[model samples]
Target: MIVFLCVRFLVFSFVWPFIGGWREMYAANDAIPLFINMDYMKDPRYFAISFRRFFKNFLNNEDLRPGIYELRFSKPEKVCVLENSVLSSERTLDVIAYAPRDLATENGVSFEKEIYVRGSAAIGQNNDLRALVCDGDVSLAKNTVLRRWLDAEGNISAGEGCNLGVSLTSGKECLVAAGCVFRRLYGAPVKAGTSRKKSFALAARDDEERVFPPPPLGAKERQLEEIWPYSDTRFSVITPNRLWVGANSRILGHIKTYGNLNVDDNVLITGNVFAEGDIVIGQFCKILGDIFAQGSVSIGEGSQVGRPGKIKSVVGNQTVFLSSGAAVYGYVTTEGDGRVL
Candidate 1:
């Protein structure tokens, strides 16, 4: 009995390691691998592109002419296709409407689904919409409420007291009137409370060769003692305290401030801007690069960020306010509210 017990113990000890190894290998093989592609999902036009693809594929399988029809998808989906322009006023649309030409809506219209217009689109006052995609220009009247997003291949104009929803993007210019609110905006040049012609005229009238004032005396003594270098621009300036730049001043380098930053009228900054606190930009200023603020940001009238061909960003952790005639070439975003005044 004693010899048998010793043999059993040895056998069990020798086999347990092999069994555990096998179990570990099996568990590894049973594990699932996950891959996530966030680029497409993060795109601002993701919904619009996806819907366009689906509609095109659906059209390919059908031989229906231009008219209103009930499409049978997983569920019954209503569709309206118009060869000529669409004029829907004081009505409710529960269908996905498509117009190869222009589209116009009157006051008190409610759109429950997406709309696609190959030509221009004019949305009237007091309208509620889900989404809109236009190949040409788009104009939204006063007090319109967009629930999802709006995208245009040409230009976009939103009137007063409009809610622009999650995202508003334009291929060319984007003009937003007063009392409009939005989350994200992207465009070649986004102008608030001004027309394209007027903005251009203002720019043209400004002195192209105007000289910028030199940096304030004893500026270096006031700045934080750290000298950070930028690889691309090779210019950086840092301040540990509140920063205030006088009118018509020019900063040839990037500015980083720990406290609030205030710039007076007609300032020109050649590089990026970073502020831990609130940032207030005065009128007719031009910032060549991005602006990032941990607190709220207020852009004064006629200020421009980024050049015509270049793209830049203005991002505020809190609210972002754009005064009349302010322009951002690429993107304007805020975690809280974004308003045009």
Candidate 2:
């Protein structure tokens, strides 16, 4: 009887945990709705290469054009533009354009979701394209209005008098000439002395310092500081090379560049700006963020870094030339001469 009792207790101890875990997993799986399994984008179909395959197979039809093509997403979202064809959409659903294709809107269309296109995309005059993501080139025609978050893997060229909202990102070159208004244009992020790489290293050091030295912050402040920038789940742009913003443009976001950043006249940036090379802000430019550069930084006349009356710009290992009538709201620190008129 004693031996039997001991064996039974051992069995219970070993088997109960396994049973509990299995039951929990089963319950979790059973609680999930069938609709989740049917979502192609959420299932195995959401892979990066899957997009290429899905587009290829779906665009197999010749002479594709504008029509209500039902794509099996969660609930058969409209595929406005067919494969490699010029098309237009009247539906309010976010439109997806495939590669080797051209897409245009008949009237002004607003997408609640981000527009995903494979090839070239053109928005008609007076139309608003919200949040666009494309692997190929993108062009904004005259008088077109582009709203939030435009990202392209290739080049982006905007015509005269185009209005671009915040956060334009391109993997290649970005050229917006005169009469174009923009906020936040990015070319790419590259290797540099103080770059994304340094950020990672610094973050690690901060972690170590937090444990050893312990920053002199209250518990709440320390917790909040630890959570910031990590818990903020906003989509950020990542590029590899250069960035150029035309005259009269405005950008308000955090920018990190591996190459040079050129801002034309009357530009305003309200966030942090870091460049690996030279940064030249043209006349009447306003930057409300901390500015750092690996090379020379030149602010044109009538420009202000940080807020007015306070200097918030810093240069690393280079000269900072603030022209006459230009002011940096925060103090300037540089390895070279920091001359401000």
Candidate 3:
């Protein structure tokens, strides 16, 4: 029995490092554009090549060359939409846009680069915002359409219907307006995956082991939140500070926060809500999931905690209060005190 256990342990230690390294390699290479079909490039009206010429003449070895660089002029009007838009930092290699009005680019934007939009930025309505990095704060006006993975070094504030395609990483906070959409938001580095079943199976096992063996002091294991595959739109949102999900917004993913969480009225959260501080769910809200709070939790009147008889609601280490006319479909558990008034 001892020999068997020892062998298994040695095998895991050896295999895990290789698996993790391979996954990182795959994620880094996944965004590379394999081919650019000439048929798609034929439309000069829709696909402009002004930047290619500009960069050839202006950019030297001293300037950073980006995978996708643009400095365009609007036809007939001759309005320079992308002006003086040089790679300000050699370290930056990402998609960036600077325009006063609508700027449409053919979207194959990838490679996890920093994106800066002085004015509102958009791709064609049909394009997706895939694999971009923001080394600083990202501020966008209303109704910005997006569908991609983002890594931000600062806060992210977007207006209504702004789509976070797959995953988001924020160094500080994430504030979204009403009716916005998101997939996953994380504050830490999350491991990328290739499949859903393997990821979830590993996640379930991790949950079971979390109660048994405490992790070694200084040894790193994947977080429960990091097991989900990158392809799965049903991912988790993680942050270390206050998480403010706006009114009437809809999230089709899980939320994990390290500080206070304020979810406004008429919002529909389709996954679990986990927070370290006080949590307030506003009136007329529908959470088709579980609530786990480290501090007090108060659900306002006309709010529903979970789908009818599906999942139980949990509150930790503080008071759990439910106001009048609020209906919790499943069992409610609180670590300190639970009251309904």
Candidate 4:
């Protein structure tokens, strides 16, 4: 019996690993597949879209008319539906407010729940809101504080000193005034303060007529350079220290810097920019690609980030600042606070 037990133990310990016994015990079908849907996760408008869909479905079934009504669902679930416009300035709404038509509020009003407006929304000064979604244009007066997100299908104009919490997105144009703070912004052209078409036009004209400086001595000019004379070359410029590109200079390739990157006024870069340190882009500069910085990123006035059709990104680990007239075509995000100056 002892001999039998010893032999059995030895065979189980030593031979089990070599015979693929563990694999047989735990079948492949027992393991669950792991998958993350990035399309749903990365969509900025997912919440707004879902909310609208649910509200539309509820509206189809409900028999409520064009007045303000309190809708009770299951236990503890309620919503306030406003069929017409809301132009009140006196009271605070503590429920989820849904307006099919225009919604306009006066000063000092507070909304503690989410607001969905199908038409244009004009919120007055110093109003506090949780979240706002509008299918048409939206306008927010000065000192308004949004605790969550704001989304609009048409143009969105936020007055000065507004705190746009979480994410602010616009399908067309997003015009942010000075002293406003945000975390993430997405738009076709998100402009700071106002749109400066003339500045971009002038910058483009100057780039066409401007003469490019020759490559430094002993520096090999590759065929991938995208400047006027060498518009076909594509290369990356890597540096250990800080890099300062002069004013009106054009670079067709990517730039990577270990230290801070300072770009002068009216500079045009056709490729992406990566900086380990802070990045400062001067006024009226045009960047055709993305901008990624480990440190803070500050874009000067009249600067343009991507073209009209292309989608680009400006991501900063720290704070991001956009001066007046600065425009970004796609997305702008910062882990820290983002301010429009």
Candidate 5:
């Protein structure tokens, strides 16, 4: 009996997280339905990826979007918030779910049972709660930095010459290309120096001291404290050694590939003519173009694949989009089959 109990406990510990998240995710029809602008771009394909993520996150399948406030969540009972509706806000965000649940996607499957939107639409702000904010104007380039506190926020960033939803922290740097988005959901606090009377710039390799440099007039190219262009891409091509896209980033255009592709979340692709390497695109990727993978391709979540995003078909070997939320819109005549997400 003792040995049996030990074995049972061990198994429970190892498998409980995934199993529990799965059951809780798919428990009902009103679990976690994603909310996105269906009218933005491609029709069903867009929803396919977003919907899959909504369910998975609700079911504990994946991470939450970066800039989320009261991500409406409920207890054991199925709850919902319909469109053309509003939700009231909670101070300090009194809503947080620690319970384990199953994570899965229902796709277009039917649902039966109970789901009640218990509370009225709530919307408000909490001081102690975390918030996501852009470093500067939304249209600014990668060299720009918004102000935040490291004590209260975290930063995500993208390469230079890119439109990002990510954050960039002080004394640190990230390299991203143009037209990329860095969406940061969690924020950190900004560091404060004793020189509250004026602004000072920190040295390149040192974080403890400040250096005096020629002051820039309002017209002298907005001088950033920790920002400087390191390279020039005007005469050459902008190519990252590796490419990775997060789930929440709203992206378009065909990214040229010579290495690895790791895509998660709802990635909107206009498609590419040629891509050579191991490819992994999660959730929904509206292919308005064609994708030719010279290596393995793995698709995950409830993403819509092929066609619309690619413009043609997907041809490759060792490819797979194995997930309850997996969907492909393009033509797949490849010989690859792996788990989706």
Candidate 6:
């Protein structure tokens, strides 16, 4: 079943490429010209040249069309709409990648070398991602470790129970809030253990063992949150409310949440980011959202929250901490006494 699913998904990403005659349509503010074509003595840019070359051979017509050729324009008014339009030819697909720029490149794309930008970030990963999904309403907690990204072609929300600190690569739009913590950074192998402690040394090699990265120390998943290729180590839970505790605030008693969290106000939260695991948020944290950390919760200042919601505990070994001088305005929680300085 897993194998079948994998194959199906791989095909799913390109299924739209087969749509017939959708690319020839022209998009314009006014009616499309009865017939339109580009005839430039010289080439435009690297991308433009690539496009002309693709069309010349998209149907295996190497020289059927010249760098500047004539073609009929089917859809005119809808040219602007092509941002979300489907692909009829290779030109269309490359020009208008996805419906949502944040998810794909159907709208506007700025490419610098191999790096491409759709929404507010870039897409580049040097690791294994069976599949990264950022579909539907998804949010990224302030500091969340996204072992895998999702919905580069759909809407994915972020907030609450974030801060995993792992490498992140976007396919679509990855929403990140404030006061959230992401720990993972791509670079040298993390120094772990000591002479008297555990030690691990890794160098790039060619082998399954060398290729397979260690299981990520990812945080649990929160509510209303779903990622492609789920990570098994992170926490997942729903939140009801939160009592934020910042570095400049005071903390007391075990923290407990039933809704979501939004810390930022230089206040004190008597809870940790994770005590259980599962977590979720329904609020729109200006800076932060729900938290589902497994160890510590440290949010930045001015973290926001979503609608009326509370963060709940689902696992253990959790602690929610926030950055110094951070402000919170949403709900938060924990199960044991917490501290602030």
Instruction: Output the lDDT of residue 291, model 1.
Output: 94
Residue-wise lDDT of candidate 1 within 1-341, one digit each (tens)? 99999988987888766887788788886556686666645565666677767776777755556888775656878888866565667888889888877888888899898888878999999999999989899999999999989999989999999999988988899999999999889888888995675443222245343433434433433454332222122345688988777776666667889999887777777778899999998888878779999998998988888777767999999989999989888999898999999
lDDT of 6 by residue, 1-341 (tens): 99999888877766656443244434334556677456535211223234334333432533222122233223211111123322221122212122223332222222211111124322222111222322233333222233322222332333433332222222222333333333321111111111111111111011112212222334322342222221111233233434232222222212334433333333222234433332321111121223354444544322322211232222212443432222232223334322211
Model 4: which residue pairs collide? 223-233, 224-233, 224-234, 225-233
lDDT of 4 by residue, 1-341 (tens): 99999999999889966676567567665566588776666777766777677677777856555545554444344577775475567569888888877899989989898888888999999999999999999999999999999999998999999999998998988899999999989888888995535346235655534434433444433232123322233445677788777776767667778888898887888778899999999898888779999999999988988777768999999999999999998999999989999
Per-residue lDDT for 239-286 in model 2, tens only? 346666666544435555667777777665556778888778777666
User: What TM-score quantifies how close candidate 6 is to the native fold?
Assistant: 0.19
- Evaluate model 1: give its lDDT: 0.81
> How would you order the candidates by lDDT, starting with the best?
4, 1, 2, 3, 5, 6
**Per-model RMSD to reference:** 6.9, 17.8, 21.5, 6.2, 23.2, 23.2
Q: After superposition, how far is residue 56 of candidate 4 from its true place, in Å?
A: 1.8
lDDT of 3: 0.48
* Candidate 1 vs 3: which has more lDDT: 1
Question: If both were scored by lDDT, which would come out higher, candidate 3 or candidate 5?
Answer: 3
In candidate 6, stretches whose alpha carbon ends up further than 4 angstroms from where it belongs are: 1-247, 252-254, 259-264, 267-271, 274-290, 293-341
Residue 51, model 1: Cα distance from true site in angstroms: 2.9
- TM per prediction: 0.78, 0.36, 0.32, 0.79, 0.28, 0.19
Q: Which window of ten consecutive residues has the lowest lDDT sum in model 3? A: 188-197
164: Cα error in model 6, Å: 18
Deviation in angstroms for 35 in model 3? 64
Better of 3 and 6 by TM-score: 3
| Candidate 4: 10-residue stretch with minimal lDDT | 222-231
